[model samples]
Target chain A: MKIKKNIPLIDQHDKNGFWGKFGGNFIPETLKKPVEDLTILFEKLRKDKKFIQERDYYFKNWLGSPTRFIKLENLTDHLDGAQIWTKVVSDLNGGAHKSLNATVHCLLAKRAGKKYIVGDTGAGYAGKMLSMAAKKFGLKCKIFMGAKDIKRQKPNCDAMRANNAEIVPVYTGSQTLVDAVSECMRYWVSNCDTTAMCVGSTVGPNIFVKICGWSTSQISKELLIQIKDEFGEIPKKLKLINCVGGGSSSFGFWNEFMHYNKKQVEFIGVEAGGPKNSKKHAAPLTYGSKIGVLHGAMQYVNQDAEGQIEETESISAGLDYPGVSPLHCFLKDTKRARYTAATDEEALNAYQLVTKFESLNPSLEPSHAFAEAIKIAPKLSKDTVLCINSCGDALKDRDILKKRLGK
Target chain B: MTVSPISLAFKKCKKEKRPALLTYTVAGDNTKKKSLEILNSISKYVDICELGFPHNTPIGDGGQIQTASYRAIKNGIKMKDIFQIVNKFKNRKNSKPLILMGYYNMICRYGENKFLNKCKQVGVNGLIVVDLPWPDNKKFAKKCKKKSVTFVQLLSPTTSKKRIKKIINDSHDMIYYISMLSTTGGKLKISPKKILENYNSIKKINKSKNIVIGFGITIKTINSLKKADGLVVGSAICNEISKSINNRQNPVTNVTNIVSLLKKRIS
Candidate 1:
């Protein structure tokens, strides 16, 4: 694998929040000023020394930064092909990579003199993480979640309640993540003066996508160094795999490696394929979905011929969204990142295989990625390094796993 | 350029020395025939009628309008049905100008050119896309202008003085001023006086533009906001339709009576 020179980095977006015509601020008039103010404040804070120090302190001391990057020796030996490594983001506080963005947003809220923080969640990890961060920062917290997700991710909902965050049930269309986001945005419209909306993923309007991506990019920032330190240099024929819901964890995992030559380091995003025979899956990119706007950004959306958003189904509550991130859409069009889908049965099989082989329990969201890695790992050369971001723990998924796996 | 029907309606209201009454209802709320009958009944009292395209996910709407949309969508309302409603309402005698209100996804799916052509053919005088705001709506607004359809722009209390100027300059014939920072059907968070003050500040940017205040203008609050060029009552009308359906009464007659009362208050 030869390294190429002068390749433009995919990390930067234009001032209007567009990543190759994918993102823009399409919010209602009631939120224009508030979104503008947030963007201005975030831009200033990202450059301020004191603000950076405060955010880093929380990332390192409170939420546990630089989570481990280790090889899955047993799984690699069993595959007998590429060596598999994982960035154990599930080991972080709040038990997922969601805390990174939540901590940054809570800090942003405090810096802006806001007394309350609001957020939306799908799998409940984001809501729980925001609740934990808000408690640490002494700000009032409210989380809007789809009524369906409330039932699916009950343990995390209980954890959010234990943290004293008020949970608002969204019973609108599909009763899922997309509705939760819409409800949260409506709530933010009225409460913008006193509250800051902490968007859970790299979706939403331009500012939110930028903010979430900026905060979570720390994953690749650390992984870049960890690779050099572990193997003496960046490995040739490296492949990175991560699951895409609203594409937060995967974007963070692949951010630093995006500038590398596409031939040397490949990026793969796995989407939820739902049931084996069901047509209702959450793989918008894999299904060749049309470009449409939802939740304030233009992206690949699962919509009907009449442009109405279609309902999506997935065993993992987080990945069951009708739209993907704008950045992922850009990557897909540019042929920078390859995307595929893993069925519910495959993810469940991967979950079992990981637990049995490595004594590790990964959340159902990343099990999609592991399923994809398992398929292609055996076909790759033994010298290739395949890194997967185990983004969350399966503790919150006990109920679903129990019913599905009967274990 | 020929004056849009929306502009002509505003001029007529100015001559009458009263704020123009604008009523909103879902296109196929309850049923297509009843929804059209309701429109025909209410058109006699209102200057502009806004018919909503029922969306499964209406983010900017509150409980009342969301319920109205759900009822319409559940009854199998389609895009063609909304256009047919507009066409039938326009064919009626002494019909008011109709404005189609919906999210942008519908337009994207229908193809912008084809959607605009359909609106032109159906006699849709104006459009108010809830999600497509300034800069983003520039292209679509121009497309509407080419089709002789007024593309209504929206302003809110949160709009900065600088942005107000830009939006008003690009506005077609009318601008919607959200009286408060909330979704449709919310309780008025700010005083009518404060909202007027904000409205006046925006009005000063371009006095010629027809600015209507919406988002929480009920019968109780309509009289107080009657000094503006126009007043839009959406959720209140939607609430009336819901109540009429629950009571097993004629929704068209009940909705007409409410709009008549609202018009009398402003007049």
Candidate 2:
């Protein structure tokens, strides 16, 4: 298999990890050396032929890459406007696109001679994938999860435990993803010598964002080819939509298509808006949050005037975060992508509609993207093709769906 | 350049042949008044006073300091109230040099120039933003220098020699050496001898800078690290306050007593 040679948009960050003044390494002094080492090692590994071959082998064999890109014909007929399609990343092993990053990082940790892999999770998909990957790579895994999230995401927790990963319950502020990341960083500070932190999303310091983005960019690398194979040419007017919690899947899905003209290819990112009538949504980018540092990266953050990070509310635990990925912040500022929010009610409605029309279940995170796509599909012409990234399956969200949707 | 109050305190400690005893307590740990009382009482034995601004999320801190910050923020401690405490501390006679330490988001939210000006107005001699390390802090440190506020640079065991030279070269009158690879208040992971060894390597880069060792500096470990220019005890003090609050004792007396004991041990 020949490796493609194209400069990815994710590699445009400066030496300090700033993507036009969005991301930087705003970490503690103890993490400086480790982060720098990881950066150097990642730069070398990404360019190494052997490393690429190893990563590609796993992408092909383990994760079932080039995940099905199928047109949602029934859903498109129901909407009666644009041709709706989906990159079914939900079909990947571990049931989410997170496996791609987790596989890459676990491999990197193995090459770096690390004995332990540590990570934090909000929705538990990342944690489950990391645990599975760590088990595959024969490394010890410890996952830090918020106590509240542990209750809601019990199945994923059980999955992680089944994979022999230790779950460290974080009882700090808000008992959510933000605090979990903070605690994970604190734990990494003490154990960095023997541990590699597989940050869940593109929301951490420069190296993490770069690593996650690079690993997940395989999504678009496949989608670009699938698009040509299906349509015999890139569609004249195409819209790619994906949900943005920490914006990993969206960045992955949009990275290769970024170089296309904005007129020909439109990028839309949907954020969780919590409840319809409440102001306590996790739509930092859509709500225009100020730039502030959280978990070692400067990004659009939901912070009070006094700079205290505010607690976020969303039905999807994965999207219930106060800060967004710095790369998404950059894309929002540069007008390279249009960002909006889908309230919980709209997302639930999308989940029901997609299940009824297409017989497919998406996690609430990507349900936001489907909600946005459903809303806008009717406004576009029939010739227009809109693709949404179904990044994860809703199996782990059964408790939430049962409670909210009454089974 | 004229000597700053922080430099003067280090000089006094050098004259006495002892490491300057620095005590850190979160501002408004239990309440604004009690926090100020703790500061005032501890200042008698402390060479330099470090007051931390309570944050909702203090990532660099461990469990003890996080509890203290929660208590302070629960009591509705605001930025203005912290500045008021500093102002009141400075109003008293013979008050030691006070340094404000916290995460940088608060300063960024409060406006860098305005926060530094408020520190200057409240007699804050130095500032230590834990998350702001080298290169990222260069501009803010320059701003602090212009305002006569020493922006404390932090050195860790993990910092490379090249980076150490760069940080020490750009350091102000005072530098803080994190004694180990842990958050504030963690148990000392390395022996005092090893910590001093690391400290000496950084001191060799610039002996003129007043360097202090912080993190995991508890009662059992303070005496062994007395050979350094200064030693900072934060988690132990915060733990004492927590104990006093839980036991319904006067935190001021109990905290001051422990600080005095730490000072004696270092001496």
Candidate 3:
């Protein structure tokens, strides 16, 4: 069946409504009206030139953007047949792709007249981003994280504390992403009058998705220039691949590429396959799940026939979730993007190969994306310059690497 | 408030001068056959019945309802089985319509149209979707009309006059006014005067439909709402069944005792 292209997701031209299959606000009853209020107030704030000017000042002076992209010369030589390039998102002010988005969200919240910000973070990158942004904006910030994550990503927790952000460690339901998100929603419900829960990924159908989408523009903008300069011609098969760790990076790349339909570039989304064939992975789109809304957004989910969520797991903490970005669901259904998975071992091997050859370490989450590149690279010739997003650095995964692989 | 077609069916079967006894049991709480026997025995006394479809996360539900839902789900109560339970009740001599009350997540997962069609095929008289926002879905009401099923709407004291009018206008089934803002069980203090006033107001707006009060309706409260079309009691009776569980054995005697006691309240 031929799936329709460019599904109507956004409300107005600037609004981010739905992406191919994923993205919508699927929130609990208590947070519904408050989210609507935030949406309207945010629209009003987004237009204020003063807010934009203040945000630009902070981005340039506080969170430095235009972070230089490093060419992986050593890795390209080792790969032999492939011209490999990885975006050094860690060079950004907050040291991850999250800063690019979280700062935007914090500024948006300030413009919306919100006094405080509440958010859930699994990898702790987004929490740090929100904390720093909140500090610059002179607003309070609260971050909910998994208890296990609190111990694993202590550096981020400390950074958030340094920014004077409130840290809440949640221990419910595997003590992971699901629980932190639940706690964040609870906090939003209680403090909706004073705060806006800024989601870091394109997970929810809120301003956070738009913020993340905008942040990811760096990848597309940089790639557009780099590809043109290196190839001396606009490349043909411009396949955009990204790790689906709540889909922020994928959205960043896809948002820029989705408009180029005639390019006919296949957008590939890679989710973690923790232990392939085992029930320990976060492949919600591939497995049969219901198309109900969550986190105040409508999309496909790993819900039972009755629409209750089924628990999902993975080796990478950030990718281990029972849900996906709703727009991804739409994309998958409409065939705009093909959603697939790679095993834990494959990602680990790819992660090591990138670090050993390129002399650049990447977060385990993006290694899943690399794994996909490795699979597709063997099929293409030297002409193929597959752009796989390197979402974060290996510093975040040092402990994870030690536990999974001996030093 | 005068009873509407759906609640009137429940009120018709209710014994006069007796509290309307409603059985609270999971569709497949124990084994399917065992649950069926419990339903058959309880059906003899109760005026209206509620069959809960179990789920993994029964949020907003207290311990008793949660346990009941777990047992039913564990015993394999698929959405298809709910229709069979209602069908069995339809085959019985009862005049009340078998009502299925559950969360919206379950309905969404099950495909709303498919579930409604199954409900109609099984001869279910009414449905209480806990998640369906009231009056906002006229299309859903139209679907219920086609199936001859009453789409139940909840009206709490928090419901304003404007909201109530919208609910009454949109509702295909009788109005189900929650006694309190809390979950289905617990010792809640509900004002009879408030219920009477809500009921009176609903009647004034549309005397065509029945207005039953649920969430918290004990014998005392039921008597107080004598002007009410009927009383809908649940978690309390399920709590009673839960107390009698000794070594996972079916608490048939407890179910019988609760029904008799509830019937005696009106008598």
**Per-residue lDDT for A88-184 in model 2, tens only?**
9999999899999999999999989999999999999999999999999999999999999999999999999999999999998899898899999
Top candidate (lDDT): 2
Q: Against the true two-chain complex, what DockQ does each candidate achieve?
A: 0.76, 0.81, 0.19
Judge the docking of candidate 2 as incorrect, acceptable, medium or high.
high
Question: What tens-digit string does per-residue lDDT give for candidate 1 at B1-267?
Answer: 788889999999999999999998998998999999999888889999999998776668888999999898889889998999999889988999999999988888898999999999999999999888898889899999999999999988888888889989999899999988889999998899998988888888889999999999999999999889999999999999899989998888889999999999999
TM-score of each prediction:
0.97, 0.98, 0.77
10 residues in a row with least lDDT, candidate 3 chain A: A7-16
What TM-score describes the B chain of model 3?
A: 0.87
Model 2: per-residue Cα lDDT at residue A369: 97
Q: Could you give me the TM-score of model 3 versus the true structure? A: 0.77
Fraction of the true interface contacts (Cα pairs closer than 8 Å across chains) found in each model: 0.71, 0.74, 0.20
Count of clashes, each model: 0, 0, 30
Shift of residue A379 alpha carbon in model 2, Å: 2.1
Q: Report the lDDT of model 1 for residue A286.
A: 94
- Go through the candidates in order and give the C-alpha RMSD of each one to the true structure: 2.0, 2.5, 5.4
Error of 1 at A293 (Å): 0.5
Worst 10 residues of 1 chain A by lDDT: A1-10
Among residues 3 or more apart in sequence or in different chains, the pairs in candidate 2 whose N, CA or C atoms overlap within 3 Å are none
TM-score of chain B of each: 0.99, 0.99, 0.87
